[model samples]
Target: MEPTRLVYEAWKRTEKIIQNTKDAKGNEIVREVEFYDPYDVKHMEKIDSRCFLCGETIQEGIATKHVFSDVFTDWNRSRYPIGTHVCPACSFTILTNPKNRTSLRNFSFVAEEKLHLPNRVEMRQFLVEPPEPPFLIVLAVSQKKHLAFKGTVSYNREIYTVMLEETEVIINRKEFTRLLAIVERFLFAFTKTEVQTGQYNQQRVLKFGIDRWEWFEEQVKPYRGTELLNVVMFVAQKVEREEDVLCFMGLGQKTKTPPQPHLSFMPSIEAETNDVDQADQICGDKLNDSQKQVQSEQIQLELF
Candidate 1:
């Protein structure tokens, strides 16, 4: 992570903090900073995303309520800085508690048939600090119309704001890598197939089974086609530290094993095997002589 010219506040429970440091010119400078402000929030965008705090499915036009990050404290206060979304029910809970991070609201990922939802990113007693043992929180983007399920941070949070428009954010390479890892883990299931045959059969029998995730090499990874990856990868690269997230989407630890080699069978397809072959034979039996002769020539040509 490359260092940037910026200031960060170590969240203090009571007293404000100050530190003296020398700048590029070796001139002593004093800076005042405060930790992430308490949950002053705004409305959510009506569509394109599910609230990270609440398991609310959002849609457009029908619901005029804009889904927004619960941040802005005062309605008149113009500094409605970017934040993660929370639905009305969850929003009321937070308004009553102001600082509550944990929710009874259930979360899920479309990544796997049976998914393990990660733990919520706990609000520290002070400010944002390095996790004791690194953990993750997963967020899902709802699929509607022709859209497919996607993993993301914030839908309303504009990417270019942190990039082109200067903000208090300073990003480093380590943070970028961490975000990419989140995307790869949440979206990994798209690469798998139920019908295990040829190359696909080999891919499903991953050594780690459900516990492990496929790695993303950037150039090679494709989820919901490459278009989705490009948006996510760009968001991972561009967003500020606030967007750096991981989901402990797993309910609890299970005895993870390297799944046995060979392939797991698809019962639906395997069960119909005899029926398909029998139908084909029946069709072939009914062919007239001229039709049979034509079929034979087509088969010969295919072989040739």
Candidate 2:
């Protein structure tokens, strides 16, 4: 893939890192530094080689392991095999000139047949401008191990935040769309309000204070299965509107509830008989206890 203008600009801004070191005599000296030097011309030789990244033939190129040690880290041994070369241009792009270089551990890239966890500006360009579906961008949460990473996916040209578990990278479009619809419906149906106070009067003011991403994480991400549906259904039920429920469920049109069939004329005889039998059993027990109590009281009077 061709790098975007943003990537090129970022490359232009890159510069070599300089470091100070002490000599044997304890005199400090400044030197230009690089993780892997691309300009050490003593090792440069013309050989027919192919670049691993862009798949282009290179007349003057260096092995990927020499210059991409920091960028690919352990991936070089697995993803890009040995004897693979990278042209100077591609090396610059990958290394980003060292000053602003990024590693493969900061962002998660999920694509068909490949999954890479790393952050680079160039990678973001690809995600934002993908040719097809099933692409996701998850920013790694290096500080919090228990919390999920924040992810974004593009749908219909709109970006939505999604909470991703530590191991998750891909999400289906159907689920993404369903969640988007729920969030939109809730925001549309509810308008937040706050009370405002003045010297002489107090009034309530409407505010759009809730952020969609934060609300989703706090109120929706923790639930799953029937609980998730119930949460949304509860909100819809509170509004007490059929249209809201339909909209929250991603239904576009309102459906009329079918009228209940009349059952008054066709009552079940077995149910009626069971109810009568139960009632008779309860009354008979009560009567027997009352008669025994009265007999006991008469015998006590005769003894007296």
TM-score of each: 0.16, 0.31
What stretches of model 1 exceed 4 Å from their correct place? 1-131, 134-221, 225-232, 235-304
Give the per-residue lDDT of model 1 (tens digit) for 1-304.
0000011011222254343445799797764323223233443335554434333443421121232225522333111223234434334312222343322112211111111222211111001222221111123222111111111211111111012111122222222222333343333333322211113333544632533333222212323233323323333311122111111112001213222111121122112234223422433344566543322222211010
lDDT tens digits by residue: candidate 2, 157-243:
233232233433332222332333333344343421111011111221123233432332233343333222321232221222334
Residue 150 accuracy (lDDT) in model 1: 17
lDDT of each: 0.26, 0.34
Best by lDDT: 2
Q: 64, model 1: CA deviation in Å?
A: 23
Candidate 2 TM-score over all chains jointly: 0.31
Report the Cα lDDT for candidate 2: 0.34
Output the worst ten-in-a-row residue range by lDDT, candidate 1. Answer: 1-10
Q: Distance from true position, residue 11, model 2, in Å?
A: 8.9
